[model samples]
Target: WARHGIMTTNLAEAYNAILRKLRPLPLTAIVEGIMYRTTMWMRTRRAVTLQQMSNAQTPFCKKMAEYLQEKANKARFHTVITIGNIRQRWEVTCRTKGGFGSSTGVITHEVTLGHESDNTCSCSCNKPKLLHKPCSHVLAACAKIKLDSTSYVSTFYLKDRVLNV
Candidate 1:
């Protein structure tokens, strides 16, 4: 559970319930029941993914896009600076005030883009590490370069990837 980052017992309880029901059935019946349930789950997920893809967005992407939009709005006054000719490194500075009548403070973060094939990126805030998604700073840099935000997203969040799984 720790390896999978699961902090709740809901999944365990569900599995136990399923097992309890299946225990009364014959071997073949139990196998069939589990298989049917799994198939239905996969089918339902695939159908939803297809619907989302038709709209040109996966559920993950849509959620991340919303988060990025909110963060971008808050970061309206921030600036993005290109590091070099590589076009893979950028610096983003976010300005914030402690409180009313307080002096403004600046926090700078670096975003490093991944290889072209992967289309992934990371930021100094470590959000990408925890969430497995691009941070706000990375999105802000992408906006500055007029780059498509989706292009930097990991394929793991894509509909095609989910379908393939």
Candidate 2:
């Protein structure tokens, strides 16, 4: 799951459940049932995607942004330090509590913004690689600079790109 970034096996479970119900049906009946289910699934999914496009952010991106915002709010002791003459790099240090009664700790991460020609950025957390989305550290640095965090989000999570897919 980590290698493929699959968070769950719900799709496989659903397919297995459908197979169990189709086992006692005739061949043509099973085929018709599958076709009907697939058609309905596609229609419902397309409608939801279109509705999400009406918002400022895509559904997936909006959910990620909300999570980042919640984490940023808890990161009250965090600091964003810019580097390089052109400010192409940022070091974000976030202090977090360990547990209910444990001591606090500091975690530092580096985020690199590519040049205008590249239009790319990366975070040391590697969340973008795993989830194909911007990490909280990157969002925190962007917030410090008063930049739009959505600009850093991957195009795959954007409404237009998702719809195209």
Candidate 3:
């Protein structure tokens, strides 16, 4: 737009808004403000790149659409809590021995599988703080199913939460 000279009156107003906010400052203050906003923009761009890389699916753009759809379905958002075994049936349990100690209380957890945006559980435990790393409970589930303990998920996206809500 700038190359085509399609400038909008709002551009001046936007700059004015920033100037207005820093009107009482000295020269250094204005420079600092510009540098701060520039740094913020750069950081935002880098975060976007990292998130895109983490979320990339296989087979290029073709699979990318389906991968996004799967993510949209929010199929990976739920954490399976085993209360206990049920005589050949499925059982759920939430107890464990580890960072919280051997006799810790029932540790309820919120797992996020699909939604990448809000993909964090609010537990102070060592598990989710590691980000995408499986915790002890996930490890247990993987063992029960004879799979890699790290395969279990612990976070979700908007789709699952919205539907389940």
Winning candidate number (lDDT): 1
Would you estimate the TM-scores of all the predictions? 0.56, 0.62, 0.30
**Candidates by TM-score, descending order:** 2, 1, 3
Over 1-165, each residue of candidate 3 has an lDDT whose tens digit, in order, gives 252223455676777786787767898998899899877876765554444544444212232334444532432332345443431111223644443643554455443232224433222343434543444444433344554322233323222231232
The local distance difference test score of each candidate is 0.73, 0.69, 0.43
Q: Roughly what TM-score does model 2 have, to 2 decimal places?
A: 0.62
Best TM-score among the predictions, by candidate number: 2
Question: How many clashing residue pairs appear in each of the predictions shown?
Answer: 0, 0, 13
- Give the winner by TM-score: 2 or 3: 2
Error of 2 at 114 (Å): 1.4
Better of 1 and 2 by TM-score: 2
What's the CA RMSD of model 1 in angstroms?
Answer: 6.2
lDDT of 1 by residue, 75-141 (tens): 5677899895765898898765564343557788898877667777888887776667667787788
TM-score of 3: 0.30
